[model samples]
Target chain A: MRFDKDSLWYPGIGFAVAGLLLAFGQRALNRYSQGMQRSALWVEHTYDVIRTIESLSSAVSRASANRRAYQITGEPSYILEHRHSAADAHSALAALRDLTRDSAFQQKNVLRLEDLVGARLSVMDDLLKAQARGGLDPRKSASLMARARTLDTRIHGLLTSMTRYEEGVLQLRAEEGQIGYRRTRILQYALTMASGLIILVILLRLSKEIADRQKKELDLRNSTVLMEVVIEGSSDSVFVKDAESRYLMMNTSGAKMIGRPLDGIIGKTDSELFSPETFARLKASDQEIIQSGRPKVYEYSVALPAGTKTFQSSKAPYRDPQGKIVGVIGIARDVTAQKAAEEKLQEAAQIKADFAAMVSHELRTPLTAIKLVIDMIVDRTLGPVNEEQNSALVTAQRSIDRLSRLINETLDFQKLESGKMEFRVSEADVNRLVQEVVISFEPVAKGRSITLLTNVAKDLPKVRCDKDKITQVVTNLLSNALKFTAGPITVSTAMDGSDVRVSVKDSGPGVSPEDQTRLFQSFVQLEGTRSIQGGTGLGLAISKKIIERHDGKIGIQSKVGDGATFFFTLPVDRSA
Target chain B: MSPKRRILIADDDPDILAMLSLRLLKAGYDVVKAAEGSLVLALVRETKPDLVILDYFLPNVKGDEICLQIKADSALRAIPVILLSASTAALPPETVHAIPTDDRLTKPFDISILLEKIRLLLPAESAG
Candidate 1:
């Protein structure tokens, strides 16, 4: 189990406390055992003193019995035995005195017993001498025996008293030793229990720490497995490299990308796997990421066995646990298909552009020639024309104008649909632009006997828009108005909220609601409107796209019988 | 009047050349015509026209290149050039602004507009 630097001291302190408890317990046991040994020694000392006293008493009795035997049988051997018994009594008295030295009362008793034993022996000796001196009178012998008997009784009494005193000391010592032994035993048990509890606590703590470490290890292992699964399951190539640019680890996809096995890729540098040119380029970027400790995203094409594949790879600095940048980790995705699709789309756009250019040149060139020739004849540049001829030429010129308008409308719609129309956006004075469009339509209005009027708001806020495209929209609305209605057409511009609104109100045969919905759609010429003027039907659609591109809205408000107001609004250019 | 002001016109189409020449003649300007782009520069030098009108797409060379050449020549730089193109896409406003031409026009244009451009460029001639 790994112990973090911060937590290492925890177990250390625990062991220290447990050791302290053990030391204290050992001291307590030592003190208790020493007390028990001393108590036991004192008890044995008391028993030794008692045993010496009993032996001394037995020696006195045996000497007196031997003297009596010598007096009865007049045997010299009995006298010798009596002398041996006397020597035994003297040695036993000395031993009792030595053994009782720890107690003043027992020592005094031992000395008194020794003196009485000596007196009793001396009395017996005097009787023996009297017997040796000669056969004496019965009275003299009886007196000597009585004196000896009295001394012996005194000696017996002294011995009995000494034995009783030693027995009392031994009994007191035994009780004290038992009490001390019980106290020490109880103390040792308490210390042992306390030490055991501390040890159990330490063991429990150690086990808990082990369990916690095991759980952490398990969690770490599980997370590593989960991360591996996620990386392996991804379609994108994921890899890690050391600071030296050697491959540290990689997912299966990453290995597959290099066309190598996982074992072969591991510990290998990019230089070993890629061409020198590719390796140099990749190493430069990898070193940059590592040194800068930053993330980079870039696209590169690789030559693979299948084909050249484009990849968008993002690499970031991988940091160690200490937060030091250690290496690079990267993920690369194959974007070859997406790139191919984009190339195809660009090719299609080029084709459409070429087609538009062709239409503009081939069609307009012939039309220009036709219109110029027709204009020369009608304007009398060729010759003077009669009324009939001039009328016919004028009619033909009108037809050409319509055809030209159709061509221009179709081109505008196509450009708008393909998102190729370019707008030179600028801040424009809405009122002036509307007034200019109205004036341009004046000639048409006059010929048609339609009064074209303008209601331009003064000091209207300028709007951001393409001037040419806006002018085209206004022209379309005005032309449509003049064609549909004989009543006066009013073009007005004013602020509608944050936007500048331009409306071409015409007193035309009003459109139905259904036709208004489809009015801005291309190639939808309304029923009555189609017969009145043959329009390309792309005018309104192109105008709608242009207005929308300027972040504006366009619509018409009309009723079945009432006139229609074709209006569009452009957002005011706040910057201006 | 003061030797009619000479105007050089270049176009690949014969009909366009004929119509434009007739109109310019009617409008009282001495008109010079070149059917090919290769002859326009020589024609312009020979005639020393008051102005030059060039179709953007012509045989052998483009109108903008001729206009650039005319503007490049210090002696002929003052002679105004009108670059005309049939394709709006080919001669967008930015391209026209880039080329050092006096003016530009798109084709299928009205004769009045062309006349007006010529008059603006040849203000002194028009007044006389």
Candidate 2:
């Protein structure tokens, strides 16, 4: 019923005009039909008059013929003919008078015809009587026949005129009837076409509406299928709960998280899946989020059957269409590995601290002996001293110095592990550093009657490294060799792959395979090391760390009962 | 000058034994030496030095054992015994006195500190 007025055609106006035109046309047709009724009656009366006149003419003509024949033949049959003709003429005259009663023009014609028929009948009777008299009167009979013929002709003319008038009236009525039929048929056809058009329009609108509805329904179905796929196919656990806080849905991961069979968590509370203490905490957190209508995220640590583990959890309030908080949702991730690394770091820190304390305690005893003797000598407390005593004092001082060196090395190793060792790098002569170390061990080699030898590659490059630390490395190796061997200790240097290599060799019982593996470990002693010579067992370990810090390497080569050679490499004129 | 009071000392360090004996003798006390803790009790009985200085952690007998043995003997118990150890901090007061050592001297002590400690252990007249 609502229309857009900007349209070109006003269909409502067109329909109203067509309806008015049809009403006017129908009224005109009804009025014309009323007039036609009167016309029909006139035509019917005219037709009746015409039929009467024709019958009267035929009767007169027959009477005239019989009269003539009877006269000529001198027979009595003529008399019968005259009688029949008179009766027929009289009845036809009555009928014609009745038909023309309502039509004055037609009535005049009918009365004239009736008069003619009567005169004719009288003439015929006269003629017949004369014939019966049997007097030879041929002329009289013929004259009478002529009179009859004239009367017949006059009647025929009147009848023919009446028929012509009635036919004209009937032709006018038929033309009006044709016009009415055409108008009625056209109206019927127009009504049928309009109704069909309306029906077609209705069907088209309904089909379009159905198509739109089907499209919307199909979209809704597709989205519903997509949502189902997302929920079912996700790797993370997904779940939902009703307003009453009962488990309404759960995905596979959610089921595993609760440590239950798939779909077993339905209708179960958090309390059923967790320990009582954990359940209480979870419920409290859930309530907090639900009440605040905001998401709350946190992490929790739990002791499972496997081990203690940490879980990062996030929770948010589930809401209804009206935005009323219904329940809560959460996702959790295990963080056990991250927590284990933190614990390991703490344990390492504690070990370093304990090592520092042990080293301090172990070093005090040796320092005490050295200081007591030195104090006595400095104080000149000894009344007299022989050359041998003085020499012994120097030896005691040297032993104490060795003890201090061991303590310093232990401290240095501890510092390296704690990432506190500081390296001061400078350009230094690698050859000279190695030579000085060998000279310092010369006395020890002499005491054991071992030859101390060196091999320096010609034009050896200067190394960019900590000179003092490298010298300490060479000295430590030489000292170990001199302490254990009776034959010879050799120092050698070479250049290989952008680095200078320093090696110290000894003729002594070499390290066992078992001891070699632990040779560079702090506090580790080889098979013969502890019994043959006293060592803190940290020299090789410390030297290895220093070389590695210089971006080089240290290694050992030895066989049981054969001599051992220890070597280290330093970068030459290059820093790494 | 009066003769030095003879002091018998037992220590593993030859430097300490020679040094302390010389110093004590120069201080006007006769000094005797026993280089081993095992010899301290023997020196106390035989040499009968006026005082004994015992070093802890010797090769044979510990200094405290010698101290206890010397104090337990009725004849030698009268001689003052001074104990020297690197771990003087570890010794409990009761354990220190459980031995007959009159005083304790931790190692690396200055010559003056050792002298003061020795003087405290000895009788005033003999220390002078």
Best candidate (score: TM-score): 1
Interface RMSD of 2: 6.8
Winning candidate number (lDDT) = 1
Which regions in candidate 2 have their CA more than 4 angstroms from the true location?
A1-344, A347-351, A354-362, A365-381, A385-406, A511-515, A559-562, A573-576, B1-128
lDDT by residue (A1-576, candidate 1, tens digit) is 767777667667766776776677677677767876876786677677767777887888889899989989999999999999999999998998888787788778777777778888887887788789976578877887787778677767877777787678768877876786777667767766776776787778878988999998999999999998999999999999998889999989988887888999899998888778778878888899999999999788877666788889899999999999989999999999999999999988878877887886788888888999999898888889999999999989988888888878777777788877888888888888888888888887898899998998888977878899999999989988887998988999888998899999999889999888899999888877777667888989999999999889999999977899999999886442
* Model 1 chain A: ten consecutive residues of lowest lDDT: A7-16
DockQ of each: 0.68, 0.18
Which whole-number lDDT from 0 to 100 does residue A285 have in model 1?
Answer: 85
Minimum summed lDDT over a 10-residue window in model 2 chain A is located at A1-10
Tell me the spans in candidate 1 whose CA falls farther than 4 Å from its real position: A1-27, A58-86, A119-287, A290-293, A297-341, A373-403, A409-427, A441-465, A473-576, B1-7, B18-31, B47-51, B72-80, B91-93, B124-128
True contacts kept of each: 0.80, 0.43
Q: Assess candidate 2 and give its TM-score to the true structure.
A: 0.37
Chain A of candidate 1 scores what in TM-score?
0.73
